[model samples]
Target chain A: MSEKLYSISVEVNGVARSAHVPARLSLVDWLRDDLRLTGTHVGCEHGICGACSIMLDGEPVRSCLMYAVQADGHRVTTVEGLANPDGSMSVLQDSFCKCHAMQCGYCTPGMLIAAKGLLEANRHPSDTEIRAAIGGNLCRCTGYQQIVDAIHDAARRMASGAK
Target chain B: MKSAPFEYLRADSIASACEALRREGDSAKIIAGGQSLVPIMAMRLVRPSLLVDINEIAALKFIAVERDAVRIGACTRQALVERDDALASRVPLLRQALAWVGHVQTRNRGTLGGSIVHADPCAELPLAAQVLGAKMVLRSSSGARTLAAEEFFTGPMVTATDSSECLEEVHWPVWSEPRTGCAFTEIANRHGDFAMVSAACQLALDGEGRCVRAAFGLGGVGQTPLAFPRLAARLLGTKLDEAVVKSVAQDAAAQTEPGSDLFATADYRRHLAGVLAARVIRAAQEKAGGGK
Candidate 1:
């Protein structure tokens, strides 16, 4: 039997888009497969690992655990939305590159999204806060020190208004 | 692992949600926050025919302090409760316990009702609710009813709420007495992980620095959050000194019947339960400014 589909309209990465998706289609799958926004990777899919993290209504949440239909009429910010409007590397991405925060790069997208969510609310975060922000997003590479350092560096750059 | 195909219905109000649930009966499940339900669905542990999304029900998302009690709307996000300064100050134990519920991302999407309904024995929220003597409001197409935390939670992953009923809100009686203090502590393999054994205590001290009231709740040590009124009675009218605390802890360990699990042996959990009970009670006493 053909699965039923639901019509969902979501504002994704600042773009208003709509799609007909299976009711079971997760938000992450809709973004990556249907919308062709592959930056959001799926790791555990069970709300752990945080690789499928995305900003839902300005708050970071596990997209894999949310159905695409549940996100209808909502605003979603994927990792692709973290860059500047002009498409240049954002400060956080730049700091991650400079700090050598990734090795396999699988977890980088979720980490960046998580950091962006945190920075939006907290302009200046302490080391503990940085650690707590990325606590859910696991990175097997860089030993987490460089990731923390990158976030710290990004916070400093953002605070200095260096943009 | 994708969930089995299911119909999705967005609920704009609690009445509509209950109506849908009543019509669909066992075939329908309510999804708030989708933190716990989605995970179980993905694993194929539950395959309901319909998922009633209650996230848009704005009326079910609030934290209100009325009179001497705090009423938390079922859909209020865990992160919102975690950061609410007023709630933290009023029900300090809840704030401390919330920190141990998953992570910031999970808490951002998880709801108070979801955690309470999920009723994981290791969950901190249920234990905290039990310790606070919280009451859960259940609504259906028929009408509404209330159940105490002790009565609401029947067993692990089980609740007294029927399929036609939606948990509306949870009411926690605020500890407003002078020098009242509370504490929640657990032993988890990692931060934000499910506890192997957890303990929560709320204490009130009289003007003479004697224990007036004490309540204790233990998690991960039983099928449901265990409360020991007899053990709590032992500390009443006495100074919560080290010796008295030790005896109470021993009684708690002996009273609980924690089963063996892969994470820890039953004896180990029992031991930790006692140690945690003592430590948390002492910590609560210290917070109340009554500890020696």
Candidate 2:
């Protein structure tokens, strides 16, 4: 017989989404495959890469490490949710573009989520704090200097009342 | 890579979790934070027939500070433990070691009991737990029992906790001494990577800067984290001079049986064990001695 399925209802990007998933269905797969929110990339299906990071109840965590059933009653925010209400890029994303933070862009979504998570709690993070925040995320390109610069610039912009 | 399919059971109560574990026996696995478990599962290194999720069990998630000990429930997130100032005041080594844990994202979900039970020999929390001589409470449908950290950790990725048992909580002894100081440090390729060698030291000093009570340990150089109570006793009545600290750290490192891997040779890990153990011990001593 096939594996049993469990139903879960998660609030994704502020919208309540429900699905029937197998016990082994990872949260990242549910977001990308079933929900069609492909912004969250999958890299190194294990927890190391952090490419599948998402905010669970406002705290960033590795979605690949969690099964979809584990997120049944939780609120999840993917990279797609980081955009402005008018669908424009958020300041952090804008800063990333302004700094050319991404090369091939594979690691950008997770990077944005990690940086956003850091900024929400720490309004003005130091360079060391920014590096530590994105330490789990691995980008073979950009050497991480640009990503750190973008996050540093975003913090400055946000502090100066830039929407 | 993907995990092998399994039956998912979310236990609402600790007792129910124990019952489920007892029923499934060897074929079942308890998933708390899934930080360590999921990675292995995705690699297909572990494929349990039943996956018991204890994350939602409210009884398994708590941090209670008692008169001489701090009891942390099994599912308490590492981030919560890292951020809790009061708990840190009671059990200072916990936060010191947690700083070197995976990262914000993983720490946000990883649980203390999970890390200790998963029991990677080089894990930061397990090394801290070893140095602090923490007590782990294991529960099954039959009953609950406690084991000391040294006894609980048998080998790499192994614990005294059996398949039928659920780790309910961990009790960390809180040193009430006024001059108690603790420190934890590790050498890893990356900030979040597993350490090549890790050291933890917690020492209490009297007003005269003489060691009264001390505990120190090293990880990544042994089957399980190794604590040196007898060697630490040699520091009693001393001011923790460089000679004694170096001697104790070297002696402790000599007893370890580190394995050679791609990252570090056994000899190099042994060498680092001595260096790091001495570093942390001095740091802890300086803190207790008020930097004198």
Candidate 3:
């Protein structure tokens, strides 16, 4: 027997969006395939990989591990929403570019979102805190040292009153 | 990794959820954080025809400190529980256990009630709940009843909760006895992997610093989290000296029936449990005395 699909209305990336998704439709699928928010990549599909990481109500979560219907009425932020309203890159985004934090860039979106969450939580996270914050996220291409350096640079720029 | 399709039901009330579960019968499953269930569903391990999303129930997200107990609603997120000021002040062991549960990302979405209902034998919350003698509140269309930690878990990934019932809340007793302390220790391959062997120990000291009440719980050592009642009795009324603590830890480890897994053999786990028991007990004792 198949389950019924439900129409759920959720605010995605500051825009109120609605979708009719099957109960089995993962939140990552809804964002990447249905809403065309490909910035949120799906990796492993299981909770092991943080490639589908997104901010759910200002908290980082693996979108693949949640149903689209479950995110109804919740605020979701994807990598595309990292830019300002004027489409300018955030400090973290610019830092990634400046620090050459992208090798293959497969895990870049998830890394950016994860770092975005960390910066919002603690604008001045220590090296250890930075490591702990992004521990769930994995980058097979660029060694994590670059990601850590990018986040630290971003934090420094943000603290120095730089946009 | 598409999950098997199921009829999605957004329940606003506990009564409605129970009724939906009853109507759907064994073909229904309730989802809180969907951290564990969604993955299992994607794996097709469970293909319930009805998917009950209980996130809309606002009543199931509170943590209240009661007179004799702390009442935690089922939908309480692990991060919220870990960061809760009251829980940290009263039950620091809970925070310690929370750090061992999973990484921050997983903890952000994993719910306490969902973790307990999933009942993974190696799960940190259930093991901690068992050691703390927590009580689960199960509600259904018929009525509600409370079950202790040991009774709540029947076997691996199984609980006493019936098909028609949903876990409402868990109540953990608050210890007001002075000079008492608790500690939890777990060793895993990574930050979030299943623990090889974990121990939770509570020590209560008397006026002369003698052990008054001692409780020990061992995890990942059997089909269910176990308590070392006999070894606890041996520690009670003792001076908590190094020799006595070592003896009690060895006895506690001997009582375990650890299962052999790829990460550790049963004998190795038993040995680790003994070492951990001794370490955690000593730490709890030192903390009780406000020392190193």
Candidate 4:
């Protein structure tokens, strides 16, 4: 059976984009397939795994559970948006590398987006807060200590005004 | 997996949302946050013919402190509730329970009304609402009405709200009495996962440090959030000593009718409910005593 389509205009990664998609099309699929922004990974189609996490209106949300139509007229920041204007690695990205936060890298994008969302709200999050922020993002590789360390390190670096 | 094909309609106002719901009837589903609904849709568990998107209904997203109660608009995000200092102070138990709702990401998109309407027996918000004796405001194209939490939740994933009726807001009473405290405790498989067993308690102590009133709610151990008036009555006029609390907890646990699930056996859940009831009651007592 043919599916109905809806037009959606969203501001993704600071850019205005428009698309005509199926009503059931998830934002993650639209981003990965239509928009060609493949950095956002989809692990569990359900909301359990945070691999599909993205910033919806500056707050981390599971994109896999959100329809593209629902994202219409909203702002979404995927992992691709976490880079500097000059295309260099963002502070959190660099910290992830420095701390060896990812081994298999399957869950990196969601982890970075989650960490970015956390550092944006709390520039100086405690260890407990850091743990809670990335608690949704499941990283089978790093055992989460490094991910927590990366977020903590990024928080400190950002607080110190380090670029 | 992708959800089945469906038509989508965005409602700019509550009236329009209600109209759409009424027009579409049972085949239409309201999408607020879409945290729970979309996941079920992806699994092809439910295929509604139409989706009335209420995320743009700006009027339905608010947290207001009314004269006698705190009013949370149905669409208010869970994360907003978790971070609101005023809400935290006014309803500390709700905030404590929200932390256990889902992870930060899920909370960012999950709505208070959606969770309450979803009515998961194991969910934290519904249990908190039950223990707090919150009121649910339901709106339809024809009129509006309110129901208590106990009346609103009929069973697991079931509520008294009709498909045409929108859950507009929830009013949680503000405990103005002195020496009042509330606490929530749950045992989940993981930090952010749904609870295997949960307990929430509210206590009000008299000037003499005697229990004046008490309410306890148990989740993941029954079809709905379970509360025992008889058990609560047993604590009245007492100092809530370990012996009294233990007996109350035991009675509460015995009253639960948990069904065996993949997560836990019915017997294990009953046992955990007792343990959690005792723990949260003691914590509420300490908090009432001005302990952090």
What TM-score is obtained for chain B in each of the predicted models?
0.98, 0.99, 0.96, 0.97
Cα RMSD, each candidate: 1.0, 1.0, 1.6, 1.3
lDDT of each: 0.92, 0.93, 0.87, 0.91
Q: How many backbone clashes does candidate 2 have?
A: 0
Give the alpha carbon lDDT tens digit for every residue of B16-57 in model 3.
999999888999999998889888888999998888888889
Query: What is the model-wide C-alpha lDDT for candidate 3?
Result: 0.87
Candidate that beats the other on TM-score, 2 or 3, i.e. the better one: 2
Window of ten residues with lowest summed lDDT in model 2 chain B: B283-292
lDDT of 4: 0.91
User: Considering every candidate listed, which one attains the maximal DockQ?
Assistant: 2
DockQ-based class of model 2: high
- Pick the winner on lDDT between candidates 1 and 3: 1
**Positional deviation of residue B177's Cα in model 4 after best superposition, in angstroms:** 0.9
What DockQ does predicted model 4 obtain? 0.88
**For model 1, how does the per-residue alpha-carbon lDDT over B1-292 read when each residue is reduced to its tens digit?**
8998899899999999999998999999999988889989999999999999999999999999877899999999999999999888888888989988998899999999999999999999999988888999999999999999989999999999999999999999987788998889999988888899999999999988899999997999888888888889999999888899999999888888888867889999999999999999999998999866
Output the number of the lDDT-best candidate. 2
The TM-score of candidate 3 is 0.96
Candidate 3, which CAPRI tier?
Answer: medium
Cα shift from native, residue B224, model 4 (Å): 0.6
Candidate with more favorable, higher DockQ: 1 or 3: 1
